[model samples]
Target: MKWHHVQDNWPAFFEAILDRWPDADEAELEEIDGDQRAFIAYVIELTGQEPEEARADIREWLSGELPSDVVMDPRHDNHSIALSKKYVPEGEDEYDDDSRFGDEE
Candidate 1:
Protein backbone atom coordinates (compact mmCIF):
# COMPACT_ATOMS: atom_id res chain seq x y z
CA MET A 1 0.00 0.00 0.00
CA LYS A 2 1.05 3.56 -0.77
CA TRP A 3 -0.36 7.08 -0.69
CA HIS A 4 -2.71 6.17 -3.54
CA HIS A 5 -4.00 3.23 -1.53
CA VAL A 6 -5.01 5.61 1.24
CA GLN A 7 -6.20 8.24 -1.24
CA ASP A 8 -8.58 5.72 -2.79
CA ASN A 9 -10.03 4.80 0.60
CA TRP A 10 -9.63 7.88 2.74
CA PRO A 11 -12.10 7.08 5.48
CA ALA A 12 -10.87 3.53 5.93
CA PHE A 13 -7.21 4.53 6.05
CA PHE A 14 -7.60 7.81 7.91
CA GLU A 15 -7.26 5.98 11.19
CA ALA A 16 -3.92 4.73 9.94
CA ILE A 17 -2.53 8.26 9.85
CA LEU A 18 -3.85 8.81 13.35
CA ASP A 19 -2.13 5.62 14.50
CA ARG A 20 1.16 7.10 13.35
CA TRP A 21 0.56 10.57 14.73
CA PRO A 22 -1.74 10.21 17.68
CA ASP A 23 -1.12 13.80 18.75
CA ALA A 24 -2.56 14.97 15.44
CA ASP A 25 -6.13 16.25 15.37
CA GLU A 26 -8.55 14.24 13.21
CA ALA A 27 -10.02 17.44 11.76
CA GLU A 28 -6.59 18.54 10.58
CA LEU A 29 -5.89 15.08 9.20
CA GLU A 30 -9.09 15.11 7.20
CA GLU A 31 -7.86 18.21 5.48
CA ILE A 32 -4.72 16.37 4.38
CA ASP A 33 -6.68 13.81 2.35
CA GLY A 34 -3.53 11.73 1.78
CA ASP A 35 -1.65 14.14 -0.43
CA GLN A 36 2.08 13.45 -0.13
CA ARG A 37 3.25 17.03 0.01
CA ALA A 38 0.42 18.13 2.24
CA PHE A 39 0.94 15.24 4.64
CA ILE A 40 4.66 15.90 4.90
CA ALA A 41 4.03 19.57 5.57
CA TYR A 42 1.41 18.79 8.16
CA VAL A 43 3.69 16.32 9.87
CA ILE A 44 6.44 18.86 9.86
CA GLU A 45 4.11 21.43 11.36
CA LEU A 46 2.87 19.01 13.98
CA THR A 47 6.14 17.33 14.98
CA GLY A 48 8.62 20.03 13.96
CA GLN A 49 10.53 17.37 12.05
CA GLU A 50 12.71 18.54 9.20
CA PRO A 51 11.12 18.34 5.76
CA GLU A 52 13.48 15.57 4.54
CA GLU A 53 12.82 13.34 7.54
CA ALA A 54 9.10 14.00 7.39
CA ARG A 55 9.00 12.92 3.75
CA ALA A 56 10.81 9.68 4.53
CA ASP A 57 8.56 8.95 7.50
CA ILE A 58 5.42 9.57 5.50
CA ARG A 59 6.63 7.25 2.75
CA GLU A 60 7.38 4.51 5.26
CA TRP A 61 4.05 5.04 6.95
CA LEU A 62 2.11 4.70 3.70
CA SER A 63 4.03 1.65 2.42
CA GLY A 64 2.63 -1.00 4.72
CA GLU A 65 -0.59 -3.05 4.53
CA LEU A 66 -3.63 -1.69 6.32
CA PRO A 67 -3.61 -3.31 9.75
CA SER A 68 -6.09 -6.13 10.43
CA ASP A 69 -7.46 -4.05 13.27
CA VAL A 70 -8.48 -1.25 10.93
CA VAL A 71 -12.27 -1.16 10.73
CA MET A 72 -12.73 -0.44 7.04
CA ASP A 73 -16.48 -0.40 7.44
CA PRO A 74 -19.14 -1.26 9.97
CA ARG A 75 -19.74 -4.61 8.21
CA HIS A 76 -16.05 -5.49 8.32
CA ASP A 77 -15.98 -4.49 11.97
CA ASN A 78 -18.66 -7.10 12.66
CA HIS A 79 -16.55 -9.80 11.02
CA SER A 80 -13.55 -8.98 13.21
CA ILE A 81 -15.67 -8.91 16.34
CA ALA A 82 -17.44 -12.17 15.44
CA LEU A 83 -14.26 -14.18 15.98
CA SER A 84 -13.89 -12.72 19.48
CA LYS A 85 -17.51 -13.00 20.57
CA LYS A 86 -17.22 -16.47 22.05
CA TYR A 87 -14.59 -15.49 24.60
CA VAL A 88 -16.33 -12.24 25.28
CA PRO A 89 -20.02 -12.66 25.92
CA GLU A 90 -22.34 -10.31 24.09
CA GLY A 91 -22.85 -6.93 25.77
CA GLU A 92 -19.97 -7.43 28.21
CA ASP A 93 -18.10 -4.22 28.71
CA GLU A 94 -14.56 -4.47 27.34
CA TYR A 95 -13.00 -3.00 30.46
CA ASP A 96 -14.53 -5.62 32.73
CA ASP A 97 -12.34 -8.40 34.10
CA ASP A 98 -12.78 -11.39 31.81
CA SER A 99 -10.92 -13.74 34.17
CA ARG A 100 -14.27 -15.29 35.08
CA PHE A 101 -14.43 -16.76 31.60
CA GLY A 102 -12.40 -19.76 32.74
CA ASP A 103 -14.88 -20.52 35.56
CA GLU A 104 -17.88 -20.85 33.25
CA GLU A 105 -19.49 -24.26 32.66
Candidate 2:
Protein backbone atom coordinates (compact mmCIF):
# COMPACT_ATOMS: atom_id res chain seq x y z
CA MET A 1 0.00 0.00 0.00
CA LYS A 2 1.09 3.61 -0.50
CA TRP A 3 0.93 3.84 3.30
CA HIS A 4 4.03 1.67 3.37
CA HIS A 5 5.92 4.63 1.93
CA VAL A 6 4.33 6.97 4.46
CA GLN A 7 5.24 4.61 7.30
CA ASP A 8 8.78 4.42 5.95
CA ASN A 9 9.01 8.20 6.27
CA TRP A 10 7.63 8.23 9.82
CA PRO A 11 8.63 5.08 11.65
CA ALA A 12 7.06 6.31 14.89
CA PHE A 13 3.49 6.43 13.61
CA PHE A 14 1.40 3.30 13.18
CA GLU A 15 -1.74 5.43 12.93
CA ALA A 16 -2.77 8.98 13.63
CA ILE A 17 -5.48 7.72 15.99
CA LEU A 18 -5.22 10.76 18.21
CA ASP A 19 -5.56 13.15 15.29
CA ARG A 20 -8.69 11.40 14.08
CA TRP A 21 -10.28 11.07 17.51
CA PRO A 22 -8.81 13.86 19.53
CA ASP A 23 -11.76 13.63 21.92
CA ALA A 24 -10.59 10.18 22.92
CA ASP A 25 -8.31 11.04 25.79
CA GLU A 26 -4.91 9.39 26.28
CA ALA A 27 -6.12 6.96 28.97
CA GLU A 28 -9.05 5.72 26.88
CA LEU A 29 -6.80 5.33 23.85
CA GLU A 30 -4.42 3.22 25.89
CA GLU A 31 -7.33 1.05 26.96
CA ILE A 32 -8.64 0.68 23.38
CA ASP A 33 -5.16 -0.14 22.04
CA GLY A 34 -6.09 -1.70 18.67
CA ASP A 35 -9.15 -3.54 19.93
CA GLN A 36 -11.61 -2.93 17.08
CA ARG A 37 -14.69 -3.62 19.20
CA ALA A 38 -13.54 -1.30 21.96
CA PHE A 39 -12.72 1.48 19.52
CA ILE A 40 -16.01 1.05 17.66
CA ALA A 41 -17.97 1.12 20.90
CA TYR A 42 -16.13 4.21 22.06
CA VAL A 43 -16.74 5.97 18.76
CA ILE A 44 -20.41 5.14 18.89
CA GLU A 45 -20.68 6.28 22.49
CA LEU A 46 -18.94 9.57 21.84
CA THR A 47 -20.20 10.47 18.37
CA GLY A 48 -23.42 8.39 18.03
CA GLN A 49 -22.10 7.04 14.70
CA GLU A 50 -23.54 3.77 13.44
CA PRO A 51 -21.44 0.63 13.88
CA GLU A 52 -20.93 0.21 10.12
CA GLU A 53 -20.19 3.89 9.72
CA ALA A 54 -17.61 3.73 12.51
CA ARG A 55 -15.97 0.74 10.85
CA ALA A 56 -15.85 2.57 7.52
CA ASP A 57 -14.36 5.63 9.20
CA ILE A 58 -11.62 3.49 10.74
CA ARG A 59 -10.87 1.90 7.37
CA GLU A 60 -10.54 5.25 5.65
CA TRP A 61 -8.33 6.60 8.43
CA LEU A 62 -5.98 3.64 8.16
CA SER A 63 -5.95 3.71 4.37
CA GLY A 64 -3.06 4.82 2.13
CA GLU A 65 -4.34 8.35 1.71
CA LEU A 66 -3.30 9.62 5.12
CA PRO A 67 -4.17 13.17 6.09
CA SER A 68 -1.37 15.68 5.46
CA ASP A 69 -1.92 17.72 8.62
CA VAL A 70 -1.28 14.90 11.12
CA VAL A 71 2.04 15.77 12.69
CA MET A 72 4.78 13.17 13.06
CA ASP A 73 6.83 15.35 15.36
CA PRO A 74 5.34 16.26 18.73
CA ARG A 75 7.59 19.32 18.91
CA HIS A 76 5.81 20.87 15.91
CA ASP A 77 2.28 19.74 16.79
CA ASN A 78 -0.24 22.19 18.29
CA HIS A 79 -0.15 20.18 21.52
CA SER A 80 3.52 21.05 21.82
CA ILE A 81 2.63 24.54 22.94
CA ALA A 82 1.32 23.12 26.21
CA LEU A 83 4.48 21.07 26.66
CA SER A 84 6.87 23.96 26.01
CA LYS A 85 7.16 24.69 29.70
CA LYS A 86 9.12 21.46 30.23
CA TYR A 87 11.66 22.39 27.57
CA VAL A 88 15.08 23.54 28.64
CA PRO A 89 16.02 26.95 27.32
CA GLU A 90 18.70 27.31 24.64
CA GLY A 91 22.30 27.84 25.84
CA GLU A 92 21.43 26.06 29.10
CA ASP A 93 22.52 22.51 29.77
CA GLU A 94 19.82 20.20 31.09
CA TYR A 95 22.53 18.04 32.59
CA ASP A 96 25.91 18.84 34.05
CA ASP A 97 28.79 18.55 31.55
CA ASP A 98 30.69 16.22 33.84
CA SER A 99 27.73 13.82 34.18
CA ARG A 100 27.75 10.86 31.88
CA PHE A 101 23.99 11.22 31.42
CA GLY A 102 21.14 13.11 33.03
CA ASP A 103 21.04 10.73 36.01
CA GLU A 104 20.57 12.47 39.32
CA GLU A 105 24.01 13.42 40.72
Candidate 1 clash pair list: none
- TM-score of candidate 1 relative to the true fold: 0.59
Q: Give candidate 2's whole-model lDDT.
A: 0.60
Top model number, lDDT: 1
Give TM-scores for every candidate, taking all chains together and pairing residue i with residue i: 0.59, 0.46
For every candidate structure, what is the RMSD over all alpha carbons to the true structure, in angstroms? 8.6, 10.6
lDDT by residue for model 2 over 1-105, one digit each (tens)? 244433444322334666777776667766665566776798887778998998788668767444445445755553555455468677764442535665446
> What's the CA error at residue 31 for candidate 2, in Å?
1.2
lDDT of 1 by residue, 7-89 (tens): 76676766777789888888877887767678778999999999998888887886777666443687766665665667776
Local lDDT at 60 for model 2: 80
For all candidates in order, the CA lDDT equals 0.74, 0.60
Candidate 1, poorest ten consecutive residues by summed lDDT = 96-105
